[model samples]
Target chain A: MKRIMILVLAITTGLGVLAYTTHSAPQADDVKVISITAKKFDFTPGEITVKKGVPVALELTSSDRVHGFSFPDFKLTAKIEPGKVTRVVFTPDKTGEFTFSCNIFCGSGHEEMAGRLIVTD
Target chain B: MKKLVLAITVLLVIALMIGVGVFKLGLVPVNADVPPSGLETRFIPIAVHASVANHAEEQPNPMVPTDENLIAGGEVYTVMCARCHGVPGRGPSVLGASFYPPAPQFTVQPSGYSEGELFWIVKHGIRNTGMPAWGRLLSDQDIWHVVAVLRRLNSLPSAVENSRSKLH
Candidate 1:
């Protein structure tokens, strides 16, 4: 009876350690940071490529006016303010080229504001 | 005594959880209607004017509006602003309708602003909101034209007067 109680305690402690490690493990990969600037209804370097499951940090800013950087598929939107840098972090879950657009109306050319995000396995 | 304390603690935890759940599942009606008023109609424009005045001090004046310049402004607005602000006669377009805070019907809500104030808002743009500044891509004259067109929107023969009554 004494041995059985000790064995049960040991098993519970082992399970606790396993659960803690698994729950606390970092789920994202270290990824390269990309910078994009929106100005006059256009994104500078309007296309970029990355690997699937890799975290991507987007450092965005507006050169002139306020603009919205939105990736609908990723459920992400970052408001880029003039003269201030905003960062958006996400791990690409799928492999494909996704489109990002400026939702803000900058002027007559606002509709032309668009960019591409490419992800590969 | 320990058992009694644990029982009281459990009751307290359950009561707290119920309170939070009730708050999260709000009891307010989703469609509670409220009548529109002059105060409601003027709120955005007033806010916009205040913001423009504040931003104007920080940003440079790159555009100057004039009668001759409005023709250029008209062309730009036709391509861009027409879709949302509408083409003087037609109502705010489909895109404007879908916005969370629907784009103000600029026709009825003509910016009660000086030409310089309009230019500053168009150049610096509003933050977080859907407005974008055109200062970088557009030449000084381009921005002036846009502002000029906005000033003319209220006077356009096609523009309907007192249309604010129709808007929710």
Candidate 2:
């Protein structure tokens, strides 16, 4: 009887741990992927709306010239070269409207080469 | 024939004397502080018009007037152009007003300026004007984006409008 009770307790704890691990383990599928195209002086979809707390993957592709994407608040920067796609994955923990600008010297409009990242609850 | 020649020589001497007098007397308005004369106002337009004759009609704009394109274009314009062209419903621009002819309000379309003409002007810039040669600083695609924005400078999409305000 004692042996059976010990085995049952161990099995119960093992199953609970197993269930917890299965429930909490993060899967690659959790990341929401969004693709954006950048050009000489602009980024398409100049405004990006995303939910806070969700892991976001941004695939930035440039069509005309090289540009740099910099999210100052998050300290995230990525280089977007011409005819190339740059990938950046990040979780937006804060909520509000944050600006992301091009760090590269693109052209006359380079200073205004910016987009809005709106993270909402 | 001798009288005609003598009269022509007198007129030439008078013209030379007047030119020298004007130079010595500081009669010309050399400062930008003073407004341009009536003839200058007319001369600038004629000069700009003559430049248009040099370039051929261009192909159509390849980019559609989608929200994405307009918004992107608006962003570019806001950064590089708004300072001079002036913004809509926002009142007159101090910097633009200081210029000799002053910058045109983008909200108002100049009569008979096609997309090609506008593109050429932006790329090459007008001589003796505040406009700079954007070709040296911007890509052709970028210039086209600005041209797209100019097409809808008055009637802009909400997204673009929002971005424009934010950019300001």
What DockQ, on C-alphas, does every prediction get? 0.05, 0.03
Number of clashing residue pairs in every model? 1, 0
Per-residue C-alpha lDDT of model 2 across residues B16-107, encoded as one tens digit per residue: 99999999999976666667788988887787777685683666777788888787778778878888887866766778777777776776
Each model's TM-score, in the order given? 0.40, 0.56
Docking class for model 1 is incorrect
> Candidate 2: misplaced stretches above 4 Å?
A1-121, B56-58, B108-111
Clashes of 2: 0
TM-score: which candidate is best? 2
lDDT per residue for candidate 1 within B20-45, as digits (tens), equals 88878995333313333467456966
lDDT string, candidate 1, A21-67, tens digits: 98875643466689999998789889999999888999999999888
In model 1, how large is the Cα lDDT of residue A5? Answer: 96
